[model samples]
Target: MRVDLHPFAGIGWPGRERCGPMRRCLPQLRDSRVGIFGVGSALAPHVSRQLDLLPALVPALEHGSPRERLARRIFDNACIDERRFCIPDFRHGTRKVLYDTLHPGLGRRMAVYRREAPRLAASACEPALKSARVAADEITHLVVVTCTGIFTPGPDVELAERLSLQSDVERTIVGFMGCSGAFHGMRVARRAALERNARVLLVCVELCSLHQRDEAGAGALVAQSIFADGATAVVLGAIRDHDRTLALLGEDRTCLEPGTRAALTWEMRDDGFAVRLSPELPSLVEGRVARFVTPLLDGIDPQVRPAWIVHPGGAAILRAVQRGLGLERDDLASAWSVLRRLGNTSSSAVLYVLEEALARLAVGAEGVMLGFGPGLTFEALRFQRGPGV
Candidate 1:
């Protein structure tokens, strides 16, 4: 019954200059006890390509030209040992390459997404429901998050069918928010739980590999080097007696860095979605993240150091956050570990980090989750380990 309410208690949305638009304050839900009860994740199983195989899989990286050499260096230092892909052609010796002189078009890529995303979602959701000790029929709400694909009768519908969720389950899709998509989904889940004591199932699935381009530009190189495929699911509801969970503390309004609308973007192109990440992104995040994040910690006891579950955008971004917050590498170990193990699975990445953090946190431990995406937007969630954890 000990609820920590300092972070978001009675905080209104910031002005347009600060947060992009006028908006109502997030509901404080002081009387409700929403919390994440279970976490599960699954990776695409078709191809597990190592960093060294990149030059072979993508001929553009094999050339010894200056741009290609630099791309190779980026690949080498990506902090990723291997990345899973739903596309089998991403492997080194595929008989038919998906990305030849002409890369796969958007339609083809989305076809793969439609086929694979639901299966991956179910793979993650099954374990999530099992761990939450909730049955499929008990779920009253479903929140699906993704940025890699889109089509009519999307993964949301397919996932419900695959999982045998109730036909009446209210569904919401948090799409195209990029890496922070899961945070939005979590927000929806929390709101539903608070409003109706709803049992909410949240799923994030990204097939970043489906959007790969053969271009040799810095942005393309970086995106290809770090992006991968995975899905993660979480079950949330009113905190139950004797339940071990990460109690939802509060969430900050989306902070859009001024004049950074173009710093990072995922845009649709004929050949799948094209990602453009400016080299200045790391420094931009480092310079502004502290200012944006400090308010959430305003009334927190200065002596208490909370765990950080950061989206692993890349090595540079992780190091920047560490330096900005003056945190030790150990503080962001889960982020780094996920990056090394799964590359950047976009929306699912932060939840993967959260899963890792959950295993290590002790009872009553508090943690902050940070995710950055398009709009150069920043999403922050504050949570604590509930009693009986």
Candidate 2:
């Protein structure tokens, strides 16, 4: 069975010390041949060059004009450049790099994914399926994780049938966990690994482009510019006898700073999931996330040769994590690319970083996976690469 687990990693407050005090423990983790799978997602409803979107861009709209300037300043601080989705403008950038889409963040449940899933699957999902297929003919379990859309009996069922997977393969759908939902899905898949003694596929797709909010004010504008759409699927399954396997180590969940609930919240709005982002998020993350990390990576090592898989929630969030974690400039290099390339794909974003870490980094590199969302919750994973020993 595969252990799809990352216990304590996030976009904020990533500490070099927290990444297991440095060095890939592949030499010590005991399991080195574990296999992990992934796909870089692409979604549609392509945003052709975004224009001067307001409302969501400025905060004063929500509270009125008394604080317009101050709100704009807050949004500006997020340090964003022009934001857009895969859609080409009247005639945008190169078609090869830029994805064509109508906007994945548009409709509700089925419509949203139905509208965008085909594109995402075509670009990201199909490849992941092939990667997994190289190793297993039968997918014992299918875990679909998403925060962007919801379909009554979700895409997992559809994907299973499409993949020629056995009808009896266990299916689990995790929805609306926001950007951190992949962690939750993987956590559940970890359990499925034990129960079924089988292969499992964990899919995380977030068409942030679809749920694009109007740039109401600075906060919304920064948010609108910063978040984009994408998806990633990781395959985790135990090798029959390989001791050095990519194994799902474990997972940890923490609810920190309860009073800050109003700071970060995602509510259903007619347009889509209108995110009620509070200014309190950054500082809140700075203050409480450190405590969460100390406990999660404790047993591994404390000397600090830790590797990191941070969610590219935003460049600011990455900064917040760096300042809090005492990490080096390269600590979150992968995360930055994900953001620069894909913006924020909601829940799927963090795992995208994890996928990068798994591919480029060597096995003994210690890693801490982290992501944040509503409920003022922080989900972390303490893990390292698989089977490369």
TM-scores for all predictions:
0.90, 0.76
Global lDDT of each candidate: 0.80, 0.61
- Candidate 1 lDDT tens digits, 175-252: 999988988898888888865657999999998877766687777778778988999999998866665665555545
Stretches off by above 4 angstroms in model 2 are: 1-28, 31-112, 133-137, 243-248, 301-304
lDDT, candidate 2, 1-389, per-residue tens: 22222233333333433223323332333442334533344444454322332333332355446455444554455444334443332233345221133232334334646655635644555666565553334678888877766776567766775666787888888878887888888778766765545777777767665565434554565576567666677666665554344434543544544577787777777656777776667777776666556555655654545777777778678888876666665878888877665567788788777766667777666677888877777877767666542
lDDT, residue 28, candidate 1? 44
Clashes of each: 0, 74
Cα distance off (Å), candidate 1, residue 71: 1.5
The lDDT of model 2 is: 0.61
In model 2, the Cα lDDT at residue 368 comes to: 73
